[model samples]
Target chain A: MDMVRNFHMAQGLGETSYAQNSPLQKEVIESVMDITLRSAMEACAAETVSIADLGCSSGRNTLSVVENVIRAVCERRREATQQLPEFMVFLNDLPSNDFNTLFSLVPEFVQKLKAEHDDGGGILVSVAGAPGNFYGRLFPSSSLHFITSFTSLHWLSQVPAGLLNNEESVNKGNIYMSPASPPLVATLYFERFQKDFNMFLRSRSQELVVGGKMVFSFIGRRSHDSHEKINECLLLEALEKSLSILVSQKLVTEEKLDSFNLPFYAPSTQELEDQVYREGSFTIDSMKQAHDWTIHEYAPKMLSNFSRAIIESFICHHFGEEIIEPLFETYTQLLCEKLVAREDIGWSKIIVVLCKSAAS
Target chain B: MDMVRNFHMAQGLGETSYAQNSPLQKEVIESVMDITLRSAMEACAAETVSIADLGCSSGRNTLSVVENVIRAVCERRREATQQLPEFMVFLNDLPSNDFNTLFSLVPEFVQKLKAEHDDGGGILVSVAGAPGNFYGRLFPSSSLHFITSFTSLHWLSQVPAGLLNNEESVNKGNIYMSPASPPLVATLYFERFQKDFNMFLRSRSQELVVGGKMVFSFIGRRSHDSHEKINECLLLEALEKSLSILVSQKLVTEEKLDSFNLPFYAPSTQELEDQVYREGSFTIDSMKQAHDWTIHEYAPKMLSNFSRAIIESFICHHFGEEIIEPLFETYTQLLCEKLVAREDIGWSKIIVVLCKSAAS
Candidate 1:
């Protein structure tokens, strides 16, 4: 399936929707708020600052990051005794994203921002939705001054090619890179990430100004090996187990499960740095690994709902919608057992700040 | 009701949707294609042309105009043997508009444009949705080069405020400024139009660069009097008749019908010229009135469907959804009788081409 045409988070504001289940993403945003604020302030030196939140799904989390950036820029300008600059924010995601819900939330967001600017000169914020794949071009040349993407870049433009040899699934019994998968499976996934990430960098290089900064936070692994046992990988293993159970019960076909692999990859810090350097347009300002240990505090059902929100569209596109309820139920039960045993529920997040090189 | 929050064409692609029943709008667009093409070519003299379609509701009609603009720009450049410039198009509408449907139509629209450009250098087009009320600021200062709002400016920012006197509806029998409306009703509506039009022009002036061009096509009347007998006024009379029937049937309350008025005004050529001169930002290039006689050929049911598509949202907001079916049934029957009587159905459309003054 074409990712651009079909991929999306669970739409709307229901209990199973991404809008209602993105507290984990909100936590990631808060954890990296300082870096986002600093980058936004530095980028706001211009008279009109253009900031784009790539892969900004439908939720308050999307605008909360933008709100933080705008507030920081306003405070910094006031401190320096400079005029508050106009802000043109672009909220970007795949075309299949829930843009209606995102836009329905804009009036109140703009109202609150304007209200907060009562003491200073009035704030000027214009938010537009730019819907497209971030792996390609989305803006004009030298148009954006700051960019942020939270927990979004792990999604490759498409499922990795070459996962099949002679029309047979090479990575059977697994939905993502795992220790049980063959080495070639990891190679194919890594190669796809390298290609997609490089294209992303190249596109942003043309769109961003010379001194523009970008802050990105996405799921990551601690080891350089692609087949490491990260928390995300473990979660996928539990999901695979649930699907396998369904397959054994004749609820889903074995061939369907074998043919399914998520279009995702959690890169290591070294891997991210290497790709950025190889792209040769951006200079890494800072890179840090953060481990959020709060996952153990959440009920297993909540975690299951969160995961479902993120992956339900993908699963439905492949396995059909009938499997969602049973699939999530089994996965939630497995998660309960794992959480009760306290089996390393920590999630490792990588935050990177990069600036467009002046000489590029 | 909040116009910015509740105002939109009917949502989705169902039979009653604006997307499915916009042939009259399509005719208006085709009628003004020459003016649109001229303004687009003039605006494309720059390297990167920024074009905005204000009040671009969800439908193919929205992108058809932009497609014409891009084609004309490309042809002009290829004739001059200049490098193909990138086009940045912004689709502006209310936040409540069905942007998902609009954005869904984009990939195919863009792919067709690119495929047609295969003989020339590859086309570079980026389309984004700018959701907001056009009566206020939407873009940064001097950011756009061309603007188009077809059949949309007739909508005022809100209903005229003085329709009531001491808690009593002044225009009790009519939903718009008909010949039977009081002189004060006409005055209030015209004053609202003047204020909203001035605000719209002012906002566009700030967003449009010097020498930029804008083409606007909207419903108009031949007579200078706001209470003149126009086809649109006649159509609203039919709608008012249908609503009165519902009120008598107790399906809708009399108070509800009395307090409801359309936030719309059709200006004469003289009124439009006066407003343009009074605003003092844009110079009138040309103004002409075009009458579409083809509307008479359509079935009365088709025309009633068209009207319903445009006003269903407004109706559903004020009246309950249960009244829609019966109301439109009465409207279609009324239209059939009017059509059989050979009533005048010619729609007067005013097309104005304006250029941003260099001095401004």
Candidate 2:
């Protein structure tokens, strides 16, 4: 997949936009807020604090997270009896992300920061948009003090390379690793994650100063087994079922359904830890897993909308825009049935806090 | 005028877009490229060179200027046998500017840079979008090494206060300074320029490191007389004439025309130098004036398009979008008659290079 061109959260503030349907991601952010605040306070000790929120898709959530970071830094500085540092917050996402909406919200964001901080016009905050893939270098070396990415890193750089063997689909009838897929499919996905995450770590290590901290929260599997039926995997399976129904109804071609695969993976906690240690530039500070029980309270329609917000671009790229409404309708029906059966519906998110190693 | 919300160049890739009608601006950039390159080479002496292009309205000209700076910095470092510095280029404009178009072009820009530089994986360049009014702070303190703003300082932070006295429009029948404007109108415009430009210098002084360089090119007058019939004033006179005709035809109200004034000023060389000295942070390095003779070579239709590209937003805000076609059509006719009469038709731009004072 051409991730840079084809991958982005649904843009704008429409009903199906990531901006509106991001409550699930917000819950994850809320769950990890304490860790994020602690890491920011510990990492920022300079006169100018540079923070970047990678994959900061357009929404109220993007700046809300940044505002919290700024507040935490100010509180820490005040307790230390130090002057407040100027802030340079770089909001990063794919070039295709809707930064117009993000930047439009900045003036209000700064105003709220000032009103709440009561810094006597001393808080200097400059918010800039850094549009690029985060698996590469996005900032200058040692320029950033704190970095945050929430529910974003599961997106691999590209669909695992070599999903086909000699032009024949190897992971047929499944868009991601599933029980029906061959073992090699899981291997390919895991390998791709390793490669992309390694590049992500190495690039950020160079960009962050020593002792700078990174806090990340993303969907992950509780089980060490690759084929575990995590909530993320279950959602994709439901989506696949919807696509199969479309194929059966002749609205989509069978070949198209067979050829598509998601550029995503929900890593096991052990897998994430192992990869971080292998990279060797960052020392693990803390890692915790939280299963969001809040999903049980959400209606199936809301879940479908949330799913569409995150993957609508990928779906539109591969299947065309015509399939969106009907496909999501079918997916919503599937979720409703699953809810009736009392099946699991919430995500297990792993939040990890890491500090840049001094020796690196 | 709400400069942040209402002022922006004509957006997108249409015939009337600033992107298409910016050849005149391109000529100015070309005229000052030597000064820009020299200032860039002299300023970027660190391992991580940070550069910002202020008021970088969306267009090819924006990145084209940045590319030249990068090339010059690399060449200088190569000559000195120093390691190439990683570049962090921030492209800044008002929040309303068309950053979507600007960012969409970044990948191709980076690809061309790498292809030409043959850096062997060494030349790291990160481009970010800074959306804010540059008259205020847009970066962290002492973080920038070089700043370039081309043809952008002409825009005041807002329209001069008190164009109305006791609810009476003082600058009637004119959108900007002109021979017909009252002397109080001239004072109001100059005072606004002094305040906005002083704020611009103070904010940038705090942002730029000591000894950092700034290269600016903007519309300026040659003669000290504010009412001199410079080409810029000539163009506005033609525009005012068109608007008067609109008022006569009932396409626009006389009250609306009287109330609307552009948030722009064309400072003379003396005015600009005096402001810089009074700001007391940046030392004047070099100042030169260049008359763009190319405006005479442009067709009247092209000139109309260029004018429309620049002020269409302001016109749309105050005079309504319905008047745009007729107003510019009338503007084109006036330009055609002026060309036939061999009248002055191009701008006189001032190119100033200033270095942040080490003592400051």
Query: TM-score per model for chain B alone?
Result: 0.97, 0.98
Tell me the TM-score for chain B of model 2: 0.98
Worst 10 residues of 1 chain B by lDDT: B226-235
lDDT to native, each model: 0.90, 0.89
lDDT of 2 by residue, B1-360 (tens): 688976899988888899999998998898899999999998999889999999999999999999999999988888888888889999999998988788888888877887777766757789999999999989989999999999899989998888977758999988888778989998999999999999999999999999899999999988888876656666787898999999999999999999988888999999988989899999999999877778788899998999899999999998888999999999999989987887666678999999999887
Pairs of colliding residues, candidate 2: none
Misplaced by over 4 Å in model 1 are A119-121, B118-121
Over A208-270, each residue of candidate 2 has an lDDT whose tens digit, in order, gives 999999999998888989975555566787898999999999999988998899988889889
TM for candidate 1 is: 0.98
State the DockQ of every prediction. Answer: 0.76, 0.78
Deviating ranges (above 4 Å) for candidate 2: A118-121
Distance (Å) between predicted and true CA of B168, model 1? 1.1
